[model samples]
Target: MDMDNFREMFLTEAAEHLQLMVDLLVQLDSDPQDQDGIDALFRGAHSIKGMAASMEYPETARLAHHLEDHLADCRQLGQISGVEIDWLLEAVDLLELLLGDIRNGRPERNVDSFIAGISKQPEAAVDCVAETKTVELTACGRGQLIQLQLQESVAIPGPRFLVLLKKLADLGTILESTPSTEDLLQGDAPNQLLVRL
Candidate 1:
């Protein structure tokens, strides 16, 4: 297919993902313990990010990346707060606007300011996970399981996780991960990383 065909497909799928995220976010607002719903939201964002990156839509990809990271945090908390839900809804609305621009053949909007605002917001503490480290040496399985905890002092754990993954790749092949490689690359700054290698 041609570039235009690809763009149309991306736009259609992205819109569907956005709709799913919004519905799930609303459901989360009512019942915060909806783990499946939250996972769906994360998947929606991740799908959008991957598609946007493939389409070379940096702004859309960047916004989707931030949204995915935010969803990851919510997933770790096992609940979503009213305030966080509000922020997510607003972000989704902005994403809709961005999609509208793309559909209309307009310039992509600058989402950096919006992304910067997310960092300014107070972050949830994952102190419980930070204090624990686990490792399992599996002689029969595919590889050993290792869990690494990040200090609260680390400003950006996502890039650090990526670096660690790269370093570990040099030693041996990585078998599996909890959040997955794409999540880390999309900047999901988790307090701990679980990898089997």
Candidate 2:
């Protein structure tokens, strides 16, 4: 395969695996005792690491490998706390950002801080508190809802969608999004994506 073709393939598959990892992490956050979720999360991280290494994205691969090892340790211990889940989610966000950089032809950014933060092992007891806090929306406090139509011929739309999602999240709390983050990460490539602030 052409190098361009290889890069495209890697981006497409990496996006799917990253999304799967995020979804599994979210599930694990809610139910830390779910062994299936833990196993799936480990596999997803491991897959991403392998793919990144094959693509010669050493930084991305190293980050993924660190996460894979962390998850494997969690699986062996049979517990993960809410704070740890938050850290993992943050790591996923960083991974998505790094992938976006590669897609945009930008140099890979250093992930040392993030890697160092999550590298530490957590205590044996798991905290079951929710990482995401529920907010009550008032009638007059509703934020704007925006709909975006991406070009149908766009290459690797999944990571692009995630970049947009992260940008939106930075501005304000996202109430909801269509084709949802989970759907987008799971390889859903609908032309239209709706977001509520």
Candidate 3:
């Protein structure tokens, strides 16, 4: 592998993802319940992880993976407070710094502090029993829920899923989505995504 070539491509892509992560973090800070924002944030971290690993940057990959895990936990618990958002933003900053070092031919920085900081935080217990819910719709709103299952073989489902969401939104107002737009954006959709419009 021509690492020089890969590094250039990685820098470009990683920079974009890092910027998106920061923007999503700011949005999440404003609305901690923003499932879409959380999903987008998670995707950014995930992309970084994948790219870093492919480029043989284990330290970068490890940190990105840890960040992705934290975001996943936040999504499951639905309890991302302002403090957590700030911590996430700081983590992003550290990632950006690490990427900068890589770009400048410096050695990978140690991310142990970041790992320790997040690990020290208390884990929120998820209410698995509360997952079930019922919704009552008016007579006029019947037939509004649409469930979509993406092809399992789709190379990258996130962008494709966004296209589907936009098409659905064009038809009518989206009342709800099962995996949520955020999850789709983050490429976390397992197989099916339900949309209510």
Candidate with maximal lDDT? 1
Candidate 1's TM-score reads 0.60
TM-score of the candidate numbered 3?
0.60
Q: Provide the TM-score for each candidate, comma-separated.
A: 0.60, 0.63, 0.60
Whole-model lDDT per candidate: 0.76, 0.73, 0.71
Model 3, 45-67: lDDT tens per residue? 99999999998888899999999
Global local distance difference test of model 3: 0.71
Order by TM-score, highest first: 2, 1, 3
Q: Candidate 3 — which pairs collide?
A: none
Question: After TM-score superposition, what is the CA distance of residue 171 in candidate 1 from its true location, in Å?
Answer: 58
Question: Model 2: residues >4 Å from true position, as ranges?
Answer: 120-197
Candidate 2, position 107, lDDT: 86
Query: Candidate 1 at residue 163, lDDT?
Result: 50
Q: How many backbone collisions does model 2 have? A: 0
Write down the RMSD of candidate 2 (Cα, Å).
9.0
Q: Rank the candidates by lDDT, best first.
A: 1, 2, 3
Error of 3 at 144 (Å): 53
